[model samples]
Target chain A: MRNILLTISYLGTRYHGFQVQKNAVTVAQTLQDAMEILLGRREDIKGCSRTDAGVHAGFYCLNFKTENPMPLPRIQRGLNGLLPWDISVRGCREVPEDFHARYDVLGKRYRYLIWNSPARSPFWEGRAYSYYPPLDLEKARAVCRAYVGSHDFSAFCSVKSDVEDRVRTVTHCGIEREGDLVTFTVEGDGFLYHMVRIMVGTMFWVNEGRLSVEEIPAIIASRDRGRAGKTAPACGLYLDRVFYDLEGLRWEEGKDLG
Target chain B: MADLENIEHLRKKRARIGFLKKALALLLIVAAIALAVAFRHEISRLNLVEQLTSHLVGIGSGPGWPVDISGITVREMAPMGNDLAVLTDTDLIFYSAQGREIRRVQHGCANPVMKVGGTRVLLYDTGSREIRVESKTRTVGSKTMEYAVDTGDISANNCVVLVTQGARYASEVTVLDKNLAQLYQWRSADSRVMVAALSDQQDEMAVGTVNVRDGQLYSTLLLFRFDEEQEYVREELAGELIHSLRYKQGCLQALSSRRLLTFSETGKRMAEYSLGEETLTAFDSGAELFTTLLVGDYREFKELDLAIVDYTGAAVGGSQLDFQVEDSTAAGDRVVLQSGGTLYLYGGGALLDEMAPLMEILDIQLVGKNLYLLTPSTLEKITVR
Candidate 1:
């Protein structure tokens, strides 16, 4: 059997997210069903991470073992043709037999979009969250800086998460503002369930003047979900990318690989 | 017999080496092809840039103009001249073609007022409940004449011909001579006037009224001639709940919850276009007879969608632009919309240009054929030739 890695993107407005649930439509279920139909076998497909409902994915990774002799290109083309319009398989490639999609992931990045306007938008109704109140930019930036470092992050994680290790290192976090639009981008070693959303919610409170930047440390220390801001809506959050080390992959000397 | 055996073994070894070489070469070739395919998207993006650069227009070598005012928002542009008036959060600024601020009218209210006009300036101060009119030309040494009316505009010379509020929403059609004196105040029969519009020639105005019954908003439109004795005529239009109304040329455009209705300035409904499930937020009429609709969240701290529709109630081709708010100022009036570090220009159903990223774009305006974008650092002029 040959292991194949696939890069995918999807608009997550319609599905329950990247994982499969009982009688619920999901990105993984659709991809798995399509693979089964094309290969005539039910092979377990593993995703790098799980994104919540209404959260988009620009670049997600998945892997599965197939015994069929069909080439990687054919599998990619077949899966793309069968997938829905909202989901797309960007690429497919053969990988080492030991390669796994989830455990091999080195880090992940996420972005949260905020539409800061006094008016509602019809076009971006499902795409972004609209915040119409005046926001304090400096306070939001300060709070974003506070999130950059290693911390338990227990207070930021959701109550329903089963993971026991809440300690995660945030490598980078920044906030940028364009005309009436603000985005929070964060890269970390790993994130707990609803961690990014809750962090964004805390930042929103900082922008709203209800919470101060100095209070972030206390919220992190509290280790209680109630101490943090309300969890941000799911629609505005997106899994931007997943990074992996390429030590084993071989490449041509003068050829650019990106 | 020993030499023959050695020769046979050497031949087998040579064949094995050849096969290994061929396999190595094949692996190298596959790796090269994969790398090329992986970078194909980046190469295509470069090609797009090259194509766009061939059609790019360079910025003119002009000196920077001084813009001292803050909270400035462009209101309307003049068709014949290079005149554009902007409403600041507190004051109104009029600019000449040379980028000189000619007039600045101050409104004492803390909240910003919405301004409307082509050559003449009408300021609607909702806080003070007053309407002020000023001519483009300096008639009284930069001092604008102000009027205090009892009710807001239910309709006026613009698409709103009457101004009314509360149960006794009184609408008065006042005609002024060149000196800004009230020539006549014509009152309407209805107590509440919700929407209004004025003709291009300033000779006629249409008024719409709303009466809420059983938690439903019902509306009516009326047209009046602005003469010595104001003549009133009621015309029937098929629509409900006029939320926004604007008059350009002789066409009266009213935005209802269901569709956009177009009527003659004389109150004749010409055509209707449905807006589907899209809600109307902010509406601005252009100088060249087009209207811009900023539809999104109407409350505080919400994102908005923008669309431009022409006079005939048709969506302007290539006029849909999306922007996201990244951060907001302390006052909440000035918001930063993320444009992905690029500037987009739209006019007449076409995207004019995607200019290089300037500072942050704060506000946009279509003045005559020139599109003016006020960035945080510069005022960019995009000429649609």
Candidate 2:
């Protein structure tokens, strides 16, 4: 038996979400159906993290062990042909057995896009957050920097999360703008549900001069969801990359990839 | 030319001042009306929040509860949200959760015992053989048994009834169906039946029996069919006194003086929960996600600490109120502990609210979702949102 790990991408605008839900058309459900059709049986697969509806993903990894004698390129072509255009199988590779997609994760990267131009763009609709007012770029940059390092991010997470521990470490967070598009890159050890969207909303609040730079640390210290900024729209979020420590994780055959 | 320009400037300034004064007067009138309307709405909204929140925290008014207690000896009171039932010495009064007395039944009682489940009520008269199942504004069923009941409980559907009677060593039990039809009867000549729990489905019963053998008290739990003595399971023990037996959801719980035990309907022991101290009195159970209230002394000071035990038999949290609590009942997702003159509200095993300075709380009953306080004079219905 060989464990096949696949990296996939999807335009989440038309899909419900990444998880398999009851009576809902989700990215996971569609991919699972395509796999069942290609393999003529069910394959046990799980995504690294769940994405909310209308949130796109540029990179995601899933692994499932199968005893099929088919080759990697053939399995990938078959599965992709069965899947919808919105979801595409980017690449598939043979990984060692016992490789999990979620638990062995080292870190993750997410990007949020914003259109600061006054004119409404039909193309960027469902792709970027549009704000006509002028934003103080330096103030936004300061709060983004404040989010770096280890801290409790309870205020940035959605209250629906029942997790007891909300402490996370952000290694990198930066904001840059070229023309009308302002891109935000955040790399963290872990992210809670809607953490990035709330952080983005808070950045704009700083730019709009509603919240101050000094209050960011106190908000993180409060550990209360009500003290945080509003959750930005799901359309502007994109899962960029997932980092894994292949050498540290247990796998058969003693082979590793970093 | 300079004098003409000055006259023109003064004329324009005067016109602007006149407009500004009129505009300011109109704005003041509009603001006053808006504030009056908002003030009225805020008062009612606060009233509604107090009536519905069920948090039982800092309440400013008794908008959806009883504000007065006219002098009357309330025999038994059952409060469940909007359906409130109060049994006086001579009449059974039904009231809404909002303190509105709806109906009064022409039923009298000598020593009455009432059990409120969901919205159904079971009232038994110890002096007589009368057992009546009632709800708000209506009598579901009534029966006159051959033996007077020491205590009784009807099923949630008002279909099955388990009534037990005992004096010294001889105790008897009767199981009845919805039409007051006798399904099972048992007489114990060598033991005293302390408590009996009838399943809500009316298919089985669990009885706690105590008998003195060799001058030692021995307790036995017997599970059997409602009508037949063909026992499904039976177990015996020698320890604390059995306080009560209750059938809630799908499990039959035996509440003892020291430990709490849950058993399946088929008589297999599921779990045993020991509170580490002797239970003071009968602990309340029978909620879906039940929070059992244990009032026992955890310190040498003899002060009672109210412990909230979740359904898993684990004490999640508790209040250190040290009040001499009489009884505590689970209402919705909250626990209402009633002592002499105070009511302690606990949610998620933590004390969320408390009401004190109350006039002698005799008993507290939760029906549906409302809490009914049976004081010396009135049956007060309170909702802890």
Candidate 3:
């Protein structure tokens, strides 16, 4: 048997989420169906992370063990041919038989997009979150900086999650603006349920002057979820990249950010 | 042999389950595609029930709808006889006065200009020489002019008047009857014809021409008879270009940049109202009893003044509005002024009602109490009451 790693991207507008469910269509189930058609048998897939409904993935990692001797390129092309247009297999590679797709992940990056315009864009429907008020990037940048380093992010995680240990180290955090699109990017070793969305939502409050920029650290230390802002919508959240190497995806301070 | 048969039967049963699963997946895909097409607008927002209701009822389509005009460029919209006509670059669509889509006709005009006359409409391409005249249901006739069309109009009787570049002169006015037969043709000598109109009575045609003389612009209003060799009545105004000219009840009403002047059929000035220094922003002479005008102090319309004047150049109703007027139209005795998403309705020289619509109002047309509003995406009808 050979263990394979796959990097994939998908537009999650029409999907329920990354996890498979009995009644709902999900990314995992779709991939399993496509792989069954291509390899003539079912293969269990392990995803690196679970995304909410309407949350997209620009780059995601997954792994599956198969006894069939298939080339990486053929597996990619064959899976792409059977999968829907919105979901695509970006790259494939061989891994050790004992390698795990989820447990071995070093860090991951997430990006949230905001269309900061009064008028809605037709092309960006279902792809971005539309915010009418003008965003103050300087204040939002300060909020992003306050989120760097390590802290218990219980204030930012959703209350529905039952995880006891919520402490995580955030490696990189920044915000960039290009024309009408505002991008908020954060890299962390792991994320709790809806943690990135909550951080972005709190940043939005700071931008609108509803919350002070200096209060972000206090909110994190308080560990009270009610102290933070509301969770930002899932449509604007995207799993941007998954890093297997610690030194490869670390962001240098004051460096050019996309 | 019996053991081999048992294994083969089990293999066949497992293969049957796989085939059934594949078939079920295909069926789900087809059903999903069907649902997406049926509820495209609502599916974008994931409001499936509202979409089903919109499809089933066809009324009360929520404040967000009448279909999003994301990719459509609406050129012009006007009120047909009893329906509303919206002309885009690719299609001419008609809707009932109740705001239900009635019919549509495909058109091929690159730079389309639409002129509505009664139940018929004239679609002309300024980039090309093609003109198509269509009724509410189907196209009546189509014609190709010798030169590029400059501007055109259609009379209530369906008589078409087109101003095109003349081969031997500056411009020409060509009139065609309802059947598209050439009724009258005249070529200008030196002036460029800015506007042309056929009288409601259909016995006369009027042309407004502008030319520069002695370093100043001069405009002339000429009325012609079909049987006459030359213009029957000619009137000239110096330094003012005529914007619109129409005939109402034997009086020829001409609106220029600075004034509204009315003249008799024999070219005698009747009653004139000077606008002084105020800039005329918009005017509509579609109504028979009154014409509505919106004026502002500067071209950048901040606060506007609305003037409703009768054909005899008398003010029926007028008011200074605090908001800028985007568009205004008059029909019967009512005038509707659209400012942003709000509409101010006036009837009998009094402010009747002020309404704030859910969608943005791009243009408006008023007929009695039924006001047709054109938004970026949909055509809506609202009653003044």
Candidate 4:
């Protein structure tokens, strides 16, 4: 037996999430179905994260063990032939049997896109969040700096989560703007439920002048869920990059800003 | 003196017994050799002798012969450009003339079926509404019908004909142009379309349909022009179910369960050949001038009689085969029959070539001089001798 790792990407508009649900279709179920056709047997899969419904992913990792010795190129071609048009297997490789896709993750980066234009784009519909208001770019950039470093983020966590330990380390938090599009990115060791969405929502509040950059640190100290802004829509968020080792990632401030 | 005479008589009796045993052993050895020679066709089907011979001669064991098709179940195949188009249960793959896979695309269908005409190939789902028209290189167009598709075909001029279940009638025929524009449509209130084909000139069409009349099933052949709403000729065939219909050399030829009927361009019945007691096992009318039929004594595992007839319903040439045929097809003037792992190619009523491939042949198609053989695990392209 050998452990096979596959990196995939999907639109996520038609899927419930990355996990198998009893009543709804999901990315994990779709991948498993395609794999079953290729390998001629069903193998259990492990995904890197439980992405929320309607949340897209640019890069997601999954692993499964199999006895079939199909070459990697043939496996990739066979899977592409079986998978749907919306989901695709980007790459595949054999990994160590002990390497777990979920447990071995060191950190993750999430990106939120905002189409800050008055008119909605037909091409980006169901793909990006459309906000018509004029956002104060300077205020949004300043608010991003306060979210870096370790802190108890109970204010940014979803109220539905019951994890008592709320302390997390945010390695990089940055905001950039390119014309009518604004991008907010955050990298962290781990996150609570709806943590990235809440952070993007808080940045939106600061951009709107409803909250100040100075109050973000106080909001973290307050440890109150009510102190943060609303969780942003799921369409704008993407699980962009997954890291098993943090030493390889290079970060720079205002690198992508227009 | 009496005891010595009795001993001599006993020795002579023992010698006679040994002589009889030697003769009996010689006769058994001769019978076994005769049986092996007589039943060689049955033994060849197990591929024991052919495999051993091919291994010793290093024939058909070379690379680049049998293209791998292990993962997909092939449903239909046809010649595309100089290559071949194979429609599986899920995908459409194009292989080169040398049996090398060139490209593959998902047809996104469950029960995928295919028809190839000129450079265009039409793929449709049997119980679904989706249909796609693709050329040798790329997809030309696609359409979704209002009702599920029953069957369809493509013309040499790239026109598409689709027969689908009707909303208000028993069946409907929709014709589309080369660019997938709606050209014409017809609906039948009582009959269901079984097979349809367009003329080579693209000016006329022939449709075969079946309907129950007074509790007796009847087959009808309808011929129509592209601009006319009503059929110019309708021939009713009682107690028959049409299996195939095609237009060849300005005449419409149709095959039913029991008869082969041909009609002239003026709606006149030219000739008809009926199978009185024998059963029609397999038939193909894809050839330019002749159609091949495999008929037997209405029983399984019986050797079939090959019948090659022209478009005028006249017998050209045929012969009885020693092996039961799985599939038979005709192209140009040659007829190819697949029985087990061997292929018999006959031209002008004479056997041209016989090849016993190393793999099992499931289906075969002879386009031009290239013979495409579908195996259980691969597709092989061989040249006719």
lDDT of each: 0.64, 0.73, 0.81, 0.80
TM-score of each: 0.42, 0.46, 0.49, 0.48
Each candidate's root-mean-square deviation in Å? 29.8, 23.2, 34.7, 28.9
lDDT of 2 by residue, A1-258 (tens): 888888899989988889888657888888889988888778878688889988999887788888887889988899889998888898788777877888767788899988888897899999888877776678888988999989989888876788888999998898888888888889888999889988987787677666788999999999876666666778889988877765433222212223
Best by DockQ: 1
For model 4, the local distance difference test gives 0.80
Clashing pairs in 4: none
List runs of model 4 lying over 4 Å from the truth: A1-258, B1-64, B298-301
Looking at model 4, residue A106 earns an lDDT score of 75
Residue B11 in candidate 4 has what lDDT? 93
Model 3 residue A112 distance off true place after TM-score fit, in angstroms:
58
lDDT of 3 by residue, A97-206 (tens): 88787998877889999999999888777888997789888888899999999999999888778999999999889989999999999988899998998899888778
- Give lDDT: candidate 3, residue B113: 88
Q: TM-score (chain B) for model 3?
A: 0.78
lDDT of 3 at B296: 64
Candidate 1: tens digits of C-alpha lDDT, residues B1-385 = 9999999999999999999999999999999789768887654433333223321212123233445444454432332135556666666666654455566677555554443433345555553545555544432212122333333331122222224233332554454432345434556565356666556454666666666665655676666676736447664334367676667556878777666678765567778766644556555554335665555432211235555567766665424333432321100011112354664544443454555555666665554545565665455555544
Clashes of each: 56, 7, 0, 0
